[model samples]
Target: MVRTQDLTYSYDARHILQFPDMHCAAGEHWLLLGQSGSGKTTLLHLLGGLLSPHGGFVEVASTRLNNLSASELDHFRGQHIGIIFQQPHFVQSLTVEENLLLAHQLAGFRPERRRAHELLAHLHIGHKSNVRPNRLSQGEQQRLAIARAIINRPKLVLADEPTSALDDHNCEEVLALLEREAGQVGATLLIVTHDGRLKDRFHHRIFLQSTQA
Candidate 1:
């Protein structure tokens, strides 16, 4: 469901980071491991079409991301890619359910309250569905982030530093939840992290070296 070839990017033309070719079949899980400045996040953004690559190509679900217009890319990403950032971001003015509904609407799909509620219930945050995101606890917020990311049943799920802030137990729980949820939807999952604990959990792993070095 995801593939990249000769992907390269740079900020100011001094250091161009080139990534190794990658291919992940549908529903497969992967670990993208790299140290700081290794371009792990850059590759994730390129795959999601958040940043245009300087060279090569990113294909997600068979679509060439580099060829899409900004608007088209936004639509395609919203519909096909679900991203879990290191920090949870949400619409402060909207309730948890509303925020998820917004995700549907933004993706050009009709808002489905039933789907939002179902996801919240599945994540054990159904009670907080009407509450503002800021009112939730840290763990609840993390679960909510997972819910939002998979709310659309996206084809690809990319998580960035998802376990960075958690204790070992919470980290395990989070990873389990992420995998289970993505698997439930048959979505391919890729997690980008520096954490070594995950190295043993996933069978398919890619370790990236800093191109600058």
Candidate 2:
């Protein structure tokens, strides 16, 4: 679950972004629609505890992010928030499976090799378990990113412009995977995107106006 109130962020004295209030229930899916410079990504980072807000607060699963120390926020985010960045990033040296295991380790949870394998299989990439990430195709890499994000069974899943680069078929495929996987984990899914292709897919949405002032 997520709740935000009077959220405001500033890059400097001259530019400040104000975000609308949001209340999303657990296990629900919502879309955050906004144009470029509207602060969609900035809001996502605040919600994920990746960026500290200059004003107001972000609460996720009942924990207020503004109250957490840096280390605490990092640990909390690792355990509770799963973020799928627009671009998938991986440790090129690690195999697909190893990358997943590393997520568990970083979260302070014991590595679950079986869970990792099962998740990859569920994502239809079990065969690539031992393969390095760079060798995978774009679609495969995307699936790997999805797999990595939810492997910890996080309570909240935040995706940024997930379908921006995909063709229609691939875009739908990726969205389906994100929804199904997040559903399986009982996570509240919030996707931040400017893509019109996604508008009709989600009934619950938050539209942000450009806060350029």
Candidate 3:
């Protein structure tokens, strides 16, 4: 569902990421393991269509991202890509339901209140529907972020340092939540983290430094 050929990136005239090829199939859960500043997060940004490549092609859902205009890219990203950042950025003034509703509406998709609630319920945090993000714990906020990402039922989900801030128990919970939820929606999972602890859970591993990272 996602493929890249000759992908390379740099910053301030210094090479940061350089991968010639990588492919993520539909329904596959990939764990991107690497150390900080090793280009894992940079790669995730490219995968999510958040940053344009310095060189080479990036294709997500079979669409060549390099060929898309700014508006087109934004539209395509909102409709096809789901991103869960290390920090959950929600509208503090909006309730949990409204935050998700905004994602749908901005993408030109109809907001389904019931579906939003169902997603929260699926995460076992449905009780926070009426609660704003300020009242939730860090773990609860992360769960809410996951719900928002999949609310559009995106075909690809990209997570950046998802388990970085959590304790061991919360880390496992977040990982399980990501796996089960991605599977339920038939979305491809591409997670980027330096934590080697996640390696055993996934078989298709992409080590950035091992091969042109």
Clashes of each: 0, 0, 0
For model 2, how does the per-residue alpha-carbon lDDT over 1-213 read when each residue is reduced to its tens digit?
899998999888889999999999999999999999899999999999999999899999999999999999999999999999998889988999999999999999999999999999998999999999998888888999999899999999999998898889989999999999999999999999999999999999999998655
Relative to the true structure, candidate 2 has a C-alpha RMSD (angstroms) of: 0.7
Clashing residue pairs for model 3:
none
**Model 3, range 1-213, lDDT digits (tens) per residue?**
999998888876644568748988999999888777778888899988889998899998899999999999999999988999998889999998899899888888999988998998988888888888888999999999999888898999999999989999989999999999999999999999987678899998888773342
Query: lDDT at 154 for candidate 2?
Result: 98
Error of 2 at 134 (Å): 0.5
Task: Evaluate all candidate structures by whole-model CA lDDT and list the values in order.
Answer: 0.92, 0.94, 0.89
Deviating ranges (above 4 Å) for candidate 1 = none
Quality of model 2 by C-alpha lDDT: 0.94
Model 1 C-alpha lDDT per residue in residues 1-213, reported as the tens digit of each score: 899998889987788989999999999999999998898889889888899999899999999998898999999999999999888889999999999999989988899999999999988999999999999877778888998889899999999989888889879988999999999999999999999999999999999999762
TM-score for each candidate, following the candidate numbering: 0.97, 0.98, 0.96
RMSD of each: 1.0, 0.7, 1.6
Looking at model 3, which ten-residue stretch has the lowest summed lDDT?
11-20
**What is the full ranking by lDDT, best candidate first?**
2, 1, 3
Error in Å for residue 11 of model 3? 1.2
Winner on lDDT between 2 and 3 is 2
